[model samples]
Target: MRFERCRMLFGDEDFEKIQSSKILILGIGGVGSYALDCLYRSGVTDITILDFDIYDESNRNRQIGSDAVGESKVDTLAYLYPGIKTINQRMDMAWVADFDFDPYDIVIDAADTTKVKIEVAKKCYKKLIMALGSAKRYDASKIEVASIWKTHGDALARKIRNELKKAKFDRNFLVVFSPEEDKCKEKGSCVAVTGAVGLTVCSEAIKRILK
Candidate 1:
């Protein structure tokens, strides 16, 4: 009954597809945490969440898990959302090789670290989605979902493209990025921009699985 409305929108068969699809998400910060929220409420029953960081007082402004400061992100999420088959681990690129890609329908990279983002981009086997440059911007309308090759203006996007090119990665991949340049270095990011990036990433994952 919890998902009855979802069943109405997707039909029973496609709703089953949504429930059965597996998604792996890296990072539990401003962007990834919001993405997790969207996917879980949208009827994704199988999810693998990985994050090496703990909630911080500073994260309260954007992250959903910000209240559980000093707790492991995975543990907090597992306790908060029960009954879903969630495989959560404190992981980073150092242990990325151990990840089994075969089971996942999609992999999302919302890590704030540029190195980690590039690593995920380079090694991901499943349909990959990454978010970039949601920081220092107040405008959520500038956020765009496009192929990584066509994405421009975001500083992180440019860096990722440079790294991918050197590695000879030619595959067209989806990226949630903003072309708007944030000029003020002292200006901080907010939930509005980062949450939009997260929701966009989740939407892309759902579309990929359904289509």
Candidate 2:
């Protein structure tokens, strides 16, 4: 009965797809953590989360598992959801170049690094829903999903777009982003905005899966 509500909402066929989909969420920070939460609660059983960083006291404000400071984010999350897989490795170009993404039905890029985001986008544009900058912004309602090419007012998205063009990456991919003007240069974040970004990314992935 864990998924009874989801079953009622999605009906039998779509709910089955939700349960069977292989999802990969990169980063276990403010945005990625909520994405994982939404997917798990919605009956996604086969999930693999990747994050190299451990929790720090500063993360407590917005990130899940922040209580386990100095502990591995992926390990802690996997402990909470034993059904999921964990990869406690950095998302560097070397790793991204070799990692196989074909196994996953959808790859959610909530990772912070722009280089890693671009590499992942280049490798798996077809199955990627990336989360753009959610920091320094307070309005969760401003968050929206759009093609990376069409996104505006997000400096991170603009940077990624320029980089992707330099790399000759022509494909357009979906991204969850807020059009709010960034408040400052400092990376200030809150669950209100980051959590909304994560949930929106999860919603987009689910919509694609059911389609």
Q: Give the candidate number with the greatest TM-score.
A: 2
Q: Candidate 2, which segments miss by more than 4 Å at Cα?
A: none
Off by over 4 Å in 1: 84-91
Error of 2 at 5 (Å): 0.6
Assess every candidate by TM-score. Answer: 0.92, 0.98
**Candidate 2 versus the native: TM-score?**
0.98
Residue range with the least summed lDDT across 10 consecutive positions in model 2: 181-190
lDDT (Cα, 0-100) at 146 in candidate 2: 93
Report the error of model 1 at residue 87, Å. 6.1
With a 3 Å backbone cut-off (N, CA, C), the pairs that clash in candidate 1 are none
For model 1, how does the per-residue alpha-carbon lDDT over 1-211 read when each residue is reduced to its tens digit?
8999989988998889989998888887889889998999989998878776778788889888789988877788878767544545555677666766667889988877787677777677347998888888878899899988898787788888888889887778789999887857874778999999999999888888889
Compose the digit string of candidate 2's lDDT tens values, residues 53-136. Answer: 989999999988889999989989988877999998989999999999999999999998899899999999999999999999
